[model samples]
Target chain A: MSEAVQLRRRLLLLTPLGVAAAGGVAFLAMLRGMQSGNFDPRGVPSPLVGRRIPDFSLPAQPPDGVGFGSADLLAAGRPVLVNFFASWCVPCVLEAPVLMQLKEAGVPIWGVAYKDQPDAAAQFLRANGDPYARLARDEPGRVAIDFGVYGVPESYFVDRSGIVRWRWAGGLSADTVSQELQPLLRKYA
Target chain B: MRTLLLLLLLAGPAWAVSSPSEMLPDRAQEQRAERIGEQLRCLVCQNQSIEDSEADLARDLRGIVRSRVVAGDSDRQVIAWMQARYGDFVRLDPPFRPLTWLLWSSPVLALAVGAGAVLAGRRRHAAPAPLSDAERARLADLL
Candidate 1:
C-alpha cells in the first residue's frame, strides 16, 4: 500500500478501538458504582425536596382512621414522615416494623393509602401493624401524584414548615431509618 | 444487532395502556394527551413510556396530562408541570441541563476522542519509507 494510504488505514483501525476502550471504561465504572451501593438504578431523586408540600387533602382511611393534609403537616410542630403505601405492596409490609419503631420514638407518621381499597387498606394496617398517627386514603391517587409519588412504600419527610426535606422511593429498612431518615429529621428538627 | 433494533423500537411490548374511559372528550385534545404521554416515562415501569405501560401510575400520569390539556396548557407547560413534580426523570426525552449536559455532550466527546485517536495514529505512522527505486519504476509503468 502507498505510505499515505497506510497511514490513513491505521488511523481508521485505531480510532474505533480507542472509542470502544473509552466506552468499556465507562461501563465498568458504572458497574462498580452499582455494586458498591453508591448508585441505585431504581432510585429516582425527588424534585419536591426543599419545596413546600403540594396542595392536597385526603379523606380519612376507612374504618375510623384519622385524615390529614398539607396544612396538617405544617401544623405538626416537628418533622413528620408522610408515607405513601398500599395493602398490595409487599415492600410496605417489609417497611412496617421500621415505621413502627419510628412511631414509638415519638416521630409523628402520617399515612396515605395509595390507590388501595378502603377495606383492604384498613385490614392491612390492622394485620401489618399501624404506626400512623393520622391516615388518609389517596383513592384516586391524585394527592399522591401531586406529592410526586411514583410507587407505594415511598416516604417523604416534611419539616415543621411543611417543606419536603427528604424523600425515599423504596421500602424503608432499619438501616435506612437510622442512617438517612433519622439524621434528616434531626437536621430539620 | 437484534438488541440495537429492540432498543430502537423501545424494547418492549407496546400495548394500549390508556383506556377509552380515561381519554378526553375532545378527540384532538385526547390525541395531544396521547402524544405527551408517549414522551413521558412511567415512574413505575423501567424504561416504558406512560403511553406504553400498564402500571397504575402511568394511567394516573395520562390523566394528569389530559387535565393540563383541558386547562389549556401548552405542550411545554404541560411538560414543565410534570418536571416540576417528578424532576427531569419523568421525560422519556431527557432535558439538556447542567446535571445532564454530560449525557447530551457524550456523542461530541466520543467523536472528539475518535478524531484525536485518528490524528495520533496518523502521526505515529508519519513519514513512511520512500518506495524502492524498482517500485517507483513499476509505479511509473502502471501510471
Candidate 2:
C-alpha cells in the first residue's frame, strides 16, 4: 500500500484509541472525586465550625408556636440536640424511636421539619409518638440551610454556650447516640 | 392530608411570599450555585453538575453551595473550599496545577509533534533538484 494510504489507515485506528484513552482518564478522575468526598451529598462543614449558631427564629408549628429560636434552646440551661428531619425521609423514621428514648430519658430535643408540609409533619410525629420538645417548620428549607444541613435526618449537638459541638449527617442509631451524643450531653448535662 | 393539600394549593399564592425557593436564600444564590455547580463534576453522575443532576450526591453539593453562602463565604471561597476537599477532579475546569499540566498540554503537544513528522517526511521526499542533464547522461554511460 502507498505510504500515505497506510498512514491514513493507521490514523483511523489511532483516533478511536485516543478517544478511549481520554475517556479512561476522565473515568478515573470521576472515580477519584467520589472517593475523596468532595462531591459529598452532605454539605461539608465550614470554618464556621467553632462559631456560635446563627441567629434566627421560626414560628413554631401548630400545637406549639413557642417562637423557638437560637436562644430558646440554647439559653434554656441545657445543651440541645436539634434534629433536622422530614416526614418523607425514611432514616428519620428509624431514628424517631431512638430520639423518643432520649426524650424519655429527659434529653431535650428539638425538631426542624425541612421542606415538609406542616400537617404531614404533625401527623408523622403523632403516629410515631412525638419526641420533640417543640417543632419548627422550615417550609422553604431556609433554617436548615442556615444550619448547614446537607439532607434530612441530620442532628446537631449544640453546647449550652450555643456553639455547635458536633454534626451528624445520617440516621442516628443507638450506638451513635450513646457513644457520640451522650458524651457531649455529659459535658453540658 | 386532604385538608393540608387544599391549604397548600391555597397557600400556592402565598408561596410567592417565599418565592417557592425549594432551597434556602434566593434567586441570586441559586443562580450562583448553578453557575458554580456546572463547573463541578458530580461524584455519582460523574459527568453532570450537582445543580443539573438529581443524584443524591449532586443534591448534597447543591445544599453545600447554599450552606457556604449562608455561612458568609464568597463564591470564590466556596469553590476553593470544594477544590481543597475534593481535589481537581471535582472541578470540571480544574486549575492548571503541576499534576494537571500534563493533562492539559498533551493534546496540543501531540498535534504539534504529528504535524512536525508530516512536514519532515514531506521534506525528505522532495527532490533536491536532479543532477544536471549532462551529469545524468555521464552517470548513465558509466553504468
Candidate 3:
C-alpha cells in the first residue's frame, strides 16, 4: 500500500477507539457536573411545568379543616408556591427555614404532605413552624403522582392562571429562592 | 455442597425482587396485570420495572395497572394512561418518537460505523507494477 493509503488505514482502525475515548471524556465531564452540584442525577424534569396544574383534591391534613385544591389555586389572584414534602424526608427539614422565609416575604405557600400520615404531617408542621396558608394530606400519594412528583421536597410555582411555570425536583436552596423563584414570581405578578 | 448453597442464597434475593405483582383474582387478568407492570418504569427506582421494584410508587402503579385491566382497558390503554400522567419516561420501552429517535437508532449508526471501519482497514494487496527494461537488463547481468 502507498504511504497515504497506509496512513488512512491506520486512522480508520483508530476511529472507533477515538469515538469511545470521546464518550469517556463526556461521561467524566458529567460526573464532574454531578460532583459540583451543577447536575442532579435524580432530577427528572417535571412534565407538569409549562402546563395547567393536574386535577387533585386531597383532604385537609390532620382532618377537620379545609384543604386546597386546583380550583383554590386558579382562584388565587397571584402566583403561589406548591411544595410537596414529607415528615420523613431529611431535606424537608433543611428546607423548612427557607420556606418560612418565603412565607414571611408574603409569598403564598401551599403545602402537600406526601404519602405521610395526616397526624405525622400536622405534627411535623407544628414542630417545623407552619409556613403554609393551606395544607393538605396526599395520604395515598395519588395527587403527587398526578403532579409527576417522584420524591419529597419537590416544588412548583403556579401562576394566577393555574399554569405551572416552574418546577424544582429537590430541596430548595437559598439561591433557588432568590434566583429562580423570585424572578418567575415577579414576571407572573 | 458450597456451590449448591451459594446458588440457593442467590435464588432468595432473585425471587425477592419480583413477588407476584398480581392483585386480580382471575388468573388471566392477573397474568395480564403482571405483563403490563413489567413494562412500567418505577419512577423512584428508575432502572427497575414496576413488577420488579418494591418502591411505593411501583406498588401504586401495579395497582393502577391491575385496576385498569379489571376495568376492561386494553393493554395499550393501560400503558397510555400511565404515559399520560407521568410522560413517556414512565414506560420502560421508549416509544419511537422524535425525542427518542437518536437513542433508538444509535445502535444502527454504530453498526454502520463499525462496518465502514472494518471495510476500510482491509489491505488491498494488489499485484506490483511490472519492472522496466533497465531493471530487466540489470537482472540479466546479475544472473
Candidate 4:
C-alpha cells in the first residue's frame, strides 16, 4: 500500500482514540472536582436534612425570666416558634417586626439568643421590643447546634409534641409570614 | 512492694488526662476551623463541605485549619493558603479565572453545539430532493 493509504488508516485508528482520551479526561476532571468538595453540581444533603429537633436547654434572660427548655417549649399546649437570633445579625433585625406582629396576634414565640452575651441580648430585646414569650440565652450556642442553625435569624415552628414542623432560613418578611408561616401554624393549631 | 510501685508508675501515664488543648479545640481556633471548613471542599467526598465531611483527610484538614487560625492567619489568608496548596480544587466555590474558565463554560458550549447539530440534521431531513428527469420518466412508465 502507498504511504498516503497507510497514513489514512493510522488517522482513522487515532481519531477514535483521541476522542476517547478527551472523554476520559473530562470524566476524571468531574470526579476529581467532586472528590475535592470543589464546586460540585450536586452537593450533599445535610444530616439534619429531614430530622427532628435535638435536645436543648437554655438559661433565662432576666426580668420575666422563665426557663425555656424543650419541656417549656412543649408546655404551651400549642405549637411554638423558636427564633434563632443575635443582635449583630442583620436578617434577625429584619425579621424582628414580623415576629412582634406574630406575638401580638397570640402566636407562641420564643427567642434563642444564639452565641450572644446575656446583656447584649437583653438590650437588643429592649431596643427591638421583645415579642418572645421567653428570652433564652444560648451562651455557647449548644441549643442552636441542636437546632441545626447554620445561620442566625432562622425560625423553626415546633409542634406541641416538640417535633419541628417547619424551618425557615434567611430573612422573613410579611409575605413569608403570610404564605408559609401561617399555613404551618394553622396545621399545628 | 517494689513490683506494685513499678506497676503504678506504668499505669500513671494511662490514667493521665489529655490537656484541654489536646482534646477539644479552643474557642478561637474552633471558630476559625468552622469558617475554613465551610469554604473548603472535601477531596474524598462528593460536594461535601470540609466542615461536614467525616472522611479522615477532612478531619486532618480541619485540624490544619484550626492550627493556621491559631497561628494568626485571617479567614481570607487561610482560604488563600488552601487554594495555593490544593490548586483551587479545595474551594467549593472556585474563583472565575483563566484556568477554570473552560471548566465553567464547557457545559454551555457543549449544549449549544449539540443543539445546533440537532437542528441542522432536522432541517436537512425536512427538505425534499428534486427528482431527476430519468426518475420522472420511470414513474410515468409505472403509471
Reference-based lDDT, each prediction: 0.87, 0.75, 0.85, 0.73
Q: After superposition, how far is residue A42 of candidate 3 from its true place, in Å?
A: 4.1
Task: Please give the lDDT score at residue B142 for candidate 3.
Answer: 100
TM-score of 1: 0.80
Highest-lDDT candidate = 1
Candidate that beats the other on DockQ, 3 or 4, i.e. the better one: 3
TM-score of chain B of 1: 0.75
What's the lDDT for candidate 1? 0.87
What is the C-alpha lDDT profile of model 1 across B8-104, one tens digit per residue? 8974554365456786789899889889988988988869989888898887788789898999999999999999889888888998889999999
Q: Estimate the TM-score of every prediction.
A: 0.80, 0.54, 0.81, 0.50
- Candidate 4, residues A15-129, lDDT tens digits: the string is 8999999999999998897664443553322334234566667778754476578777766788888888888878788788998899999998888887777788888888888
Score candidate 2 by DockQ: 0.07
Cα RMSD over interface residues, candidate 4: 12.4
Best by TM-score: 3
- Give candidate 4 misplaced runs (Cα > 4 Å): A1-50, B1-143
Deviating ranges (above 4 Å) for candidate 2: A1-48, B1-34, B40-48, B55-143
Ranking, TM-score, top scorer first: 3, 1, 2, 4
Candidate 4: residue B57 lDDT (0-100): 48
Model 3 residue B24 CA deviation in Å: 1.1
C-alpha RMSD for every candidate: 9.4, 11.8, 5.9, 16.7
Q: Which candidate comes out best when scored by DockQ?
A: 1
- Chain A TM-scores of each predicted structure, in the order given, are 0.82, 0.74, 0.81, 0.72
lDDT of 4 by residue, B7-46 (tens): 9887634311122343235766676567677888876574
lDDT (C-alpha) at residue A112 in model 4: 84
